[model samples]
Target: MTSETALPTPASPLDLGETLTFERDGAIGILTLDRAAKRNALDDATITRLGEFFAAVPEGIRAVVLTTAGEHFCAGLDLSEMTDRDAVSGLHHSRRWHATMNAIAESAIPVIAVLQGAVIGGGLELASAAHLRVAEDSAYFALPEGKRGLFVGGGASVRVPRLIGLTRVQDMMLTGRSFDAVDAETIGLVNYRVPAGAGTAKARELAAAIASNSEVTNYAITQALPRIVESGRDEGYMMESLMAAVAQSSTEAKALMRDFLDGTGPKVRK
Candidate 1:
């Protein structure tokens, strides 16, 4: 399946303005948040660039690693931009964040977020949209909007709760409490934790494994699994069966099964 929009290749990276950059490594795409001076803060331009990348992950790109340059993953939204907007404009601005975040969450390919340093407010919301999160020991999370007399305008109110639970989210927002990488893993905010500088390697390793799976199976897992989980018991089972059938019916799936039966495929890890 070809992408309608042209994507950046390893030989030629796309110029996504000043805040975002893309690089290719085999089947995995690495999208870096480049505004490190602001601790990689999310702004209007950054969100638009992110939306462009996530909205159309071209064929051959099986997975993506959403990471940042420098110490912090992200510090949250740029407050300087917020000071000029009124209530109606603020509402529209927040919805733009929701739309960009939704594009990431609903992408066809799975995204692995590499977290380090500050993952606060909108930053935490952004990471929650990814399929998997790998946090470095230096990573920390918080929602300090309440302290600033502001509320979360991103999808944090929805996605963050689904990850760590409503109670923990409330606590963070209310008290401006921060959780380290270890605590993040314990609270279900991150899937894996590694040493301070090991996050990128770990995320790449997982992305490679995911990229090796049949695209059909990966699509089913990334797309259908969430919906099924949110569905009622009987409805969930029905959706699961349908997804299973659809995944198995793919030609690639049939070939993979044939290889497995012939003892040529890799065995399950012990």
Candidate 2:
């Protein structure tokens, strides 16, 4: 194989642009949806770049935070480009979106979404892919495709149901029910709710905590836990035990245990 093919494709930060931006804060990687003039509406380039960024997170980055500029987090797809696709083109386009969503959701590093304003339609679908979501009180959630005479094609049909419930999602679609941040939290769509303009701070805090965790522990939680939850009881239990054993046997785990036993580690206190 050629040297280029033998080595993995490296991911570099894309140019600072209206569509998207990338920056790093210590061990945490920050991804920003920058098209606030359009409420950060995603076009094909933005979606593809998102997949590339998440898929090839640098080795030093332990966690990721996804946030956006302006009042809104993301408005959704760039409907201006939502024209001119035949059925086959539409299928391929939707499949590309699925691939990107999966890349983000199954990323090696845990991801936190900092959300605000209108997280509508495809925006909601994008947020659903994160491991943790910090929602500002101003944030709103909706699935308006039913009104658009369209349907979700960005892994929403699968991932959203896993985050919330099938019936609730059904209601959102059929009735065009919009959810406030509080309602989103109540229904398990978001993990944290903060005052408007504080979503990024909260997400950074969560990402720091996640980054501090043992690598194996974080990996297991981010990767294995979901699959375990979806598996049969017997299979889940087996996989759970396997993950537990692997994590406990790591060198970092041994050191952590020693610290705790020696009373040098922080104790559990509330």
Candidate 3:
């Protein structure tokens, strides 16, 4: 996790002017990129605001819905900031981006991204960080760095490859190929694809459901499942067994299991 300065005081309700908006609805923390004029292009200010918001998520929020307030979800980083710079500066710039994105990715609560329109370049990188991604029918995914004589510096090289595989990412960058929402879902890039204009609602629904789970269970899933999957078979099984035992031993888990055994909970009927 990246280092964050301690907030001087509890943050007031964010005023959504033109850059980013943060709101709390029930137990869901809603983060909307509000810079529609530039297709919500992520500039330095936007990045800083995002880092601050996620770093100090208000008390009582259990999940996050990351969405944009325009036709496009995010066009990626604002290339307008690109400039002639030394290797050290470039490395630091990339690290700053990584820090902000990592804060969102590693949030104590899970994040769900609602994607629509051009989810390209750095935009795709941001979406890849979310725990769950819901894409509208109009959504498309691409990485156009190759044609532009540039490379992804926003953690895409590490995160995107994990979601959709390295070969596919390479093909996207090399060929400027764009995948529509259905294809993205089929290829495992997106977890859900809904009709146009439904991405946000779907994401909210999923977030709400996820927020209902025991906090410990959710935390384990978000923090441990990925690592378990990457481990060797023996290691993976051991992790699963351990997590299972730990979860089952929880008071909430025991109560839920008792309810089920007593025929008072929902059954596993298809």
TM-score against native, each model: 0.93, 0.93, 0.90
lDDT by residue (1-270, candidate 1, tens digit) is 123222223322254778787788999999889888999998888887787778766558999999999999999999988887899888877877887788899888999999999999899999999999999999999999999999998899999999988999999989989999999999899999999999999999999999988899999998999999999999999999999999999998998899999999879996
Residue 246 in candidate 1 has what lDDT? 93
Stretches > 4 Å off in candidate 1 = 1-15
Candidate 2 residue lDDT tens string, 174-238: 99999999999999999999998888888889889888778899899989999999999999999
Off by over 4 Å in 3: 1-18, 267-270
Clashes of 3: 1
Candidate number that wins on lDDT, 1 or 3:
1
Looking at candidate 1, what is the lDDT of residue 219? 92
Candidate 2, residue 177: how far the Cα is off, in Å:
0.6
lDDT of 3: 0.84
Model 1 CA RMSD to the hidden true structure, in angstroms:
4.2
lDDT of model 3 at residue 104? 78
Model 3: pairs clashing at backbone N, Cα or C within 3 Å: 76-123
Q: Each prediction's Cα lDDT score?
A: 0.88, 0.86, 0.84
Rank by lDDT, highest first.
Answer: 1, 2, 3
Q: What lDDT tens digits, residue by residue, belong to model 3 across residues 122-222?
A: 89988988889999999999999899988898889999989889999999999999999989999999999999988888988998988877777887798
Candidate 3 global TM-score: 0.90
